[model samples]
Target: MAIAKTSPSIKYSFPPFVPDGARLIILGTLPGEESLRLQQYYAHPRNHFWPLIAALAGKRMPSSFAGRVALLQGNRWALWDVLEGAERIGSSDAAIRNPTPNAFGKFFSKYPDITSVAFNGQKAHDLFRRYVIKPGIVANDRLTAIDLPSSSPLHTIPFEEKLAVWHDRLAPYLPPKPQNRRAK
Candidate 1:
């Protein structure tokens, strides 16, 4: 289905942390309260998204929102959400209701170079399946969905365990760091 332009009454913005010539697109369901408030992705202090990414990228942790945005963009990674708008009571993913999911097909059509799609958690994946994947907008071969552990503190998994799983799944997608390169 085509994504219609959001109505002016809708109070939302697509905070895409995208990079040019990105081969991968990482999707989430929607911005949590902190993200919306800060006008940035993964704004919650307890969210492991940035820290894990920094570790995987082998860079010092980004100190500012612009720094984080630059890191993702520099790596040729794109970030956006599946939901354009939703009735959310608080930041909990479980609290989302009547979601107006974004038009992913349109986005993909605009950027055919995106070779892989990653979901931040199961909610985004499920939304994609119900709205886009099952509808045949996205062919299974064209994209694969990897459900990473939720970065939310609510998940209660230890940080190390989370890092292990995320590191394993995300390592292949990360652009190689200079330190990892060897002289020929």
Candidate 2:
């Protein structure tokens, strides 16, 4: 009798939070286990994603799923992962294999206004460039890619540093900050 070996299966990512009139798209590699289990992006309490985003946008961290979505949509920024599916272990990008990139063709067709893509980390940027940009599928003369520090607790870089870069890099595409209107 021979023993059988099984290969690891690829896990698929959730639907993107792309909205119409979006100018910037923030791309991550893939959601971690906690995020997948919670059916939310960056659901881990230790993850700095929400805090960084809120600080950059000059808004409070969203405490609810709907609030998070609203924050991104309101800023005309989109959120998605570069890889739609991959065989990864323990939520580490280094463990990822057999990656399948997201459908950028359809996504770009729907959100033609998107001017730039900001990658959350090197893995996301590399994957997108190798799978989509280099292939000429999503890359174009008008569209640019920016690499930002990962907000994952795994990344170890300070949140303030990441937030500064994110704010500066994305400022041009972001809408003007809202002002508090007061009436007598």
Which candidate has the top score in TM-score?
2
Model 1 global lDDT (CA atoms, 0 to 1): 0.78
The true-versus-predicted C-alpha distance at residue 166 of model 1, in Å, is 1.6
**Per-residue CA lDDT of candidate 1, range 24-107, in tens?**
887877887788888888899988888877776677889998887777877788998888888766787787777776877778
| lDDT per residue as tens, model 2, 57-129 | 6789879988878878878889999989999777888989999999998888888888799999998989988
lDDT of 1 at 178: 59
Show model 1 residue runs off by greater than 4 Å: 1-13, 179-184
**Which 10-residue window of candidate 2 scores lowest in summed lDDT?**
4-13
Query: What do the candidate models score in CA lDDT, each in turn?
Result: 0.78, 0.86
- Can you tell me which runs of candidate 2 are displaced by over 4 Å? 1-7, 179-184
